[model samples]
Target: MTKLNCPFCYNTIRRRSELHFMCRGRPTGARPACQPELDQVRSNLTGFKEATLPTFEAVSENLMLPFTKAHCPKCGGETTTRACSHCHTRLPMEFGLDASPMVAMVGARGTGKTVYLTVLSNELQKPKIRSEFAATVRPIGEGQDGFGAQDQWVRESIHQVYEDRKLFSTTAQAVDGRKAPIVLEWRGRHNRRFVLRKFRTNYLSFYDTAGEDLTADDVTFKLHYLRAADYLILLLDPFQLPEVQRLLRLPPAALLHVREGKPPIDVLARVTEALKQGDHWNGRHITVPVAVAFAKMDAFNQHLPETHPLRARRRTLGGYDEKTGRIIHEEMKSLLHEWGGDEIDAHLSGHYRSYQYFAVSALGAEPDYENYLVNPRGVRPDRVEEPLLWLMHKGGLVPRAAS
Candidate 1:
């Protein structure tokens, strides 16, 4: 029997060892005998060499196990892996049939990330994007998907503060027990049909992170997940534009910590450093097609027409139009043109890589917790789906059939 390590508590024990297996902390009596179905998994991989390992598709088709040797440092339980080597938490290799393209959400504090994620969950359920993507939004991890465990603080933070109409902050008491990370999956158009007209690319896994985490000094563990990420959606709050403008006007005034501000500059600076670090670590230009998303455009919509003198320039800036459905204010385009230049193109000539400018509003109408995000005139999104679509296209998750 091969010795294995517990993935949960990082405990290591051998199959022949006389230790009861406990996962993550839960003690399983006698390492519950492997079911007949799972026993076959062990049999198949018995003599298999690591070099000729079966593909994810093969395991999914055969209903084989998705387990690997890992050490469980806590319980001395060997054979512990992402799937339990012992006990009933065996892998459902079936779920492994499709390997999802991974995407991570990272941004600064108070960027309305939670609200944006909450709304993205609801948006993905819509017909057009849902059909095109063949995926659904869901909560995964720990109590949900039995994965690497979800962060409870993030889950409750959104629910209590935004969903439950309760105030939330680094100081405020949580109203909704604990927050869970929202994990959504969906199938993209087959690439063979679009590319070589042979096979579908891969499934997509969208993971949302809390703003607080992105700003932390040490993102060692968090940075790991982002290494192989296909795309990164960075939320940039328009509220920060004012602060940046204010500072630019008074270069010597010192950067003041604005109250209830969205996307603190200090946090943004740290996030930037982390991204650079990730690029260094991965040895790949962490240029994972970023969407410097201007979230909650409704607040900035009123200032659109009057934002800048040039009307066409304002449209290029980006905005949402109630009449035309999705509108890009010229001012936003101007800003992006100023930052990255060239009408917010995919990439600039020399500096920067894949990037785009977008304006989006999560709730359309401001989420008046006191008023339940009331839109008496009926709900209308101001270019809410552009950023996601842009990302999907860049990720090859959605095919440009015409191409």
Candidate 2:
């Protein structure tokens, strides 16, 4: 029994000890179907108003070993469906049995966090990447092999980014019900020679908060998930770099996308402070691994030398490459120094015990900002999944490259 924070509500709980379940709703002559009710706890946390299947705690005899399947208190029907104790969102059947790593994504406004998240999720579903990583990124809501998630938050995101070939609207603030963490099941095959092939399934909970939500100290501190996160994806806007912004000249329309906010280092400091606000951290350097990525690389890649490490593809194969990972880490660190963002590298080094730098472009090419459409070349994603792949490698969800 391991303890984990519920991805939806961000509350810590022992997996088996705090179990709650939902009714399957199969009506029988003996027991009628359960009625839907307004779950206030769920409505408050998720902003979902619609009444749903009744959820109840399982009554069991043994405290050491809890019941996996029990007769529903409401319907008298046997059900195994699990729900989070705090938020009541449906948990996957495999959730309590496996490791569900929380990856908290945060950055300032105008960093293109939504676009990057959309493209990254779309890229991870491609066959080439799937074959290489020996895994599939499936939405937790879908809970099936064929159709996509029933949650419109994801359906609409995919439609806007992949189907319509346009950038999706900015992610709504944390209070907005339309925004939810794109919870996923990273199911994979752990193949090893001279051994049994194991089913290695892991959960990935990515909550992409609105940039404005993290700008103020009070608001950022209230987001306790930052402290509970197993990993952090800190996205930085390239245009915010004074040196980089002045060096590149863009059309008037594209300029509309840039907006001023706290500096990148200042944003990192706020997040680091939030992580320290926890009981255990005490303002000391935290051990959580961070993947600090500069999103929208298209703005910089075109002007930099073609051979620059950031512009070149570092990951083209299946497993994680430690050698290339380090190379790019250093390359991006130096590039930051050149862009007058050395304080960012220093701040990360001082605050986080482990951190890596990456350059990712959700759209491989810059979009037509005025028309709200992708480039004429379409949304060709460049290394959008590299940060996640590296994080996966760190978690042992994927293998280390063999020489």
Q: Pick the candidate with the highest TM-score.
A: 2
Q: What TM-score does model 2 achieve against the real structure?
A: 0.91
Sliding window of 10 residues with minimal summed lDDT for model 2: 143-152
Could you give candidate 2's per-residue lDDT for residues 127-188 as a string of tens digits? 98778877778677573411133345666787787778877656568773223577777888
- Shift of residue 194 alpha carbon in model 1, Å: 11
Per-candidate clash tally: 46, 0
Candidate 1: regions farther than 4 A off: 1-97, 132-180, 193-203, 219-222, 243-257, 260-265, 279-285, 305-331, 335-351, 369-380, 401-403
TM-score, one value per model: 0.55, 0.91
lDDT of 1 at 322: 21
Error of 2 at 118 (Å): 0.6
Over 1-403, each residue of candidate 1 has an lDDT whose tens digit, in order, gives: 2223222111233442222322333234645323222234322322111221111111121236433333334332343323434322323222233344455566655566656665665565567555544544343442543333332544564455344554333322111211222444453445443344333323334445555555446752334445445566767654455533442332221112134333444554554456565542345344666666776566544445654332222212122222221234344566644533342233222223666556777656654433334344434455556666667666545544331
Give, for candidate 1, the lowest lDDT window spanning 10 residues.
Answer: 49-58
